[model samples]
Structure formats: C-alpha cells, structure tokens
Target: MHKKTMTFRCLLLAALLCPLASVAQQAPATADIRDLASSPRWLTTKVYIEGAPQTDVKANYPGVVGISTWDPERNRYEFFYTDTGKSKYDNGGGGYFFITGDHKTHVLVPDVGPTKTMVRRLETLNQCEFTYSREVPRDMVENNPLVRIHVVHAPYTGTVETLSALKPGTPATP
Candidate 1:
C-alpha cells in the first residue's frame, strides 16, 4: 500500500509540473487558446456593461454581458490576443487593457469587428465592469493574464455609447 501511494504522488506531481514546464518554454499559439478554453480547468471571465441606474437602488450596476476564457498565465496575456487571428486588425492588430475594481487585475480586450470602433468605444469609459470565474478547483482566474474579450451588445446597437457608461480601456502598448 505504501509503495502504491508513493508512486501515485510522484505521478501526480509529474502530471502538474510537465505542463507548466512546457508553458514556460514556449509562447502560446492559436491552438493553445482553443486548448485552454476546452480544458476541463478552463476559466470564464464574466463581462458586463453599464445600464440605466435604478432609482430604487442607491447604486445600480448592470450584470454580465458575456463570458469567455483566456490564458491564465500573467506573462502570457498578450499572446492570447496576438496569437489568435480572431483579434487581428488591418493596421497591425493589438489589444486593449482594462483594470478591474481592485485596480490591480486587468483584462485584455481585442477588436471584434472590422474597424477600430470598439477601440474608440473603450476610450469613452473609465472603469471596466468585467469579472471572471474558474472551473478548476486547483486554479485561479483573478489577477491572472486573461485575454481576448469580445464585447457583444445584443440587438446590434449602431453606437458604442448605447452599450454602457462604466469606463474606457487603454490600448495595449505595442
């Protein structure tokens, strides 16, 4: 029984460490984003947009707009957006960074449309109203490198101002 237990522990350690080792060695690719999303341990970031303030409540904030996952490694945030063609733009694709309520955590948003309209919209706001959750018990999504936020406003509003009034997101440094 003791021998079996020791062998099991060693195997578990290896199972965890091998992935980390490989991640550290190479920058993530497009396929990696898909893999991470499909992983049983994938994380989901809850997106929100500001809505009409309720006269009934002193402070009313809108709920999540959408949810999406990205790489959880802090150093790898840029890769998730840059590596995936989903985020590309004609004038050199880049991303936007929005800090959360804590003033420490950040979310990287990529342009989801044909023009820089999304970028222009992000410029209007000041505070990001997004949040995330993790599925795996062993991992965390907070303060980690999350990328590729595709803001979706239902019913196809032609104007970005119609979305929310939370805060603007800064463009990721080239």
Candidate 2:
C-alpha cells in the first residue's frame, strides 16, 4: 500500500479503537456481594459530626483494616458495615458504602436481602444502629486486602466528599 494510504488507514483504526480504550479505562462496576462463610475481618467507621473540625474527625476516624481468611487456600474474604442510624436529619434511609484498595471504586451496600437493620438514637446523630456480623474466621492480619467502610449518617450533604479524602488503602493518622 502507498505510504499516504497506510497512514490514513492507521489513523482510522486508531480512531475506531479510542472509544473502546476509554471504556476499558473507566472504573469497574460495583462488586457483587457474595454470601460466603462468615469473615472475621469486620470493621466500623467513626461518625463525624456536621460542624466538627476536620482535625477532630481525622483523629477519631478508624481507617482501613485488612481482610483475609485463616485457611491459606481461601482466596476471597468479606467484611460488613451496618448503617442503622435514623436521625431525623436524614432525608432518606442512608445506605452503607465500602471502598476497595484501588481507592477509586466504591460499592453502596444496600439495606436489602440478608442484611439486618436497626434504628436507635432517633434524637441524636447516632439514632439508628445495626449489626453486620461477620461469622467467617480467618487470619487476624497479614497479606490481606484493606477495606474502608463509610457508614452514611444523617444530613447526607458532603458525606461523600469527606469520605473521598480518606483513601481506602491509607491508614488514618492517630
């Protein structure tokens, strides 16, 4: 083929593949929660008040915790976060959020299926509470993946923006 013809064909092919490349680069979809044996790596996050100083928030925030199973053959593990707050300030039932180590993808674990819910402190910020008990046993800690759970609080404004600052793979400075 002529040089000009080859160049034109290459440009066309590049343009055709650009969209596919972009889609592949996009963030992956939320992970489908599986019902595996109870995982002992459960964790909870500290509640940050609406007007509390950022310094206080960071100091109290419980950062990512590692998750793994005791059996060396086990490949996947699970952790749970229960969002059972019913603050009058909450417009709708807040859902629990979990982030992976990549710090980009997050999954909004809903209040459906096997999840047990609770409501408390209807008057205070922690008016609602629930349990996401992990029953599976595994290694306490080691070469395990870290997960960050962000429990949705009432007055859901800025909650996501704040959580974004706390990367899932990074530990909170105490």
Candidate 3:
C-alpha cells in the first residue's frame, strides 16, 4: 500500500512541473518597434478623410498614410497627420498616438459602419495595425479632402510621420 501511495505522489509532481518547464523555455516578448523593421511583410497604413460623402471616393483615395512604432510597454502606436484644421468631415487630421495592437487588423465595429475599421497584421508584434476614417453623408462629394499621407518604414527616435491627401469617406472592411 505504501508503495502505491509513493507512486501516485511522484506522478502528480511530474504533471505540475511540466507546465512550468515549458513556460521557462519560451522567449521573451518583443518590446521595441525597431525589431520589426527588418521583417518582409508590407505594413499597410490607410488614412481616411474625416467627413467625405460617397463610398467610392473613400475607396479610391483610402489614404496610404505613415507607419509608427509599437511600444510594447505601453501597447500603443504613435501616429501623426498633416491636416491640422478642424472640421466635421475630418478623421485623420492631427498628430496623435493610438493604442498599439488595438488597430493591428481591420475590425468592423458597429455604430461606426458595416465594416468600420481595417487593420494590418504585424508579423512579430502581437498587436494589430490600424487606420482612421470619418462618417459621411450620401450626397456630399468632397466631405473632407485629405492633404497628404506618408509611411515610415520604422519608428523615428523622436520625430513623427506625416499623412496626406484629404479625400474623406472610405468605408472600412471587416
């Protein structure tokens, strides 16, 4: 009987340690954006005019904006735009940083549109790529005109990337 009890205890101990051993073997998470610069996949940055009517305009000029670095510690992507003026039909118009990984891929959230948001997948980074857009009316042709758009291969030490071409009203895909 004592031998049987000892055997059971040994089996239980082995099961508990197995998970811990596997976790220990895993690599540490990537924390900086520079680490992803050398990767092969193309990072797509779409910039939509804030308030442009007609889905066609938005689709054609789905502004290819700039790229920002991912701060794993903060879990956010710092983005900058060129259109400085404030308007009803403007989405990506100023310099601001968005939550990293949150916008990695295109996600369709309701109340925004049928397919409201579109995102790109970052190869090594665990976060989603993001894009911005504005609501539009059916009749409005030039609801918001994008002035410029840019893309940065990697995050700069201290500078922010610029976005251009203010043609608004691009519907996002789910």
Q: Score every model by TM-score.
A: 0.19, 0.18, 0.25
Question: Which scores greater on TM-score, model 1 or model 2?
Answer: 1
- Candidate 2 local accuracy as lDDT? 0.26
67-91 in candidate 3: lDDT tens per residue?
3333333322322332331221234
Model 1 lDDT per residue over 31-78, tens place: 122222232111122232223122211111111222222333321222
Best by TM-score: 3
Error of 1 at 146 (Å): 25
Q: Report the poorest 10 consecutive residues by lDDT, candidate 3.
A: 104-113
lDDT of 2 by residue, 58-156 (tens): 233332221211111332222222232212112212233333332222223222233322211111111232122111111224454432223322212
Question: How many residue pairs clash in model 3?
Answer: 30
Please list the Cα RMSD from the true structure of every candidate, rounded to 1 decimal place.
18.5, 21.1, 18.7
Model 2 residue runs over 4 Å out of place are 1-39, 50-102, 109-174
Top of the candidates by lDDT: 3
What is the number of backbone collisions in each predicted candidate, taken in the order shown? 6, 12, 30
lDDT of 3 at 73: 36
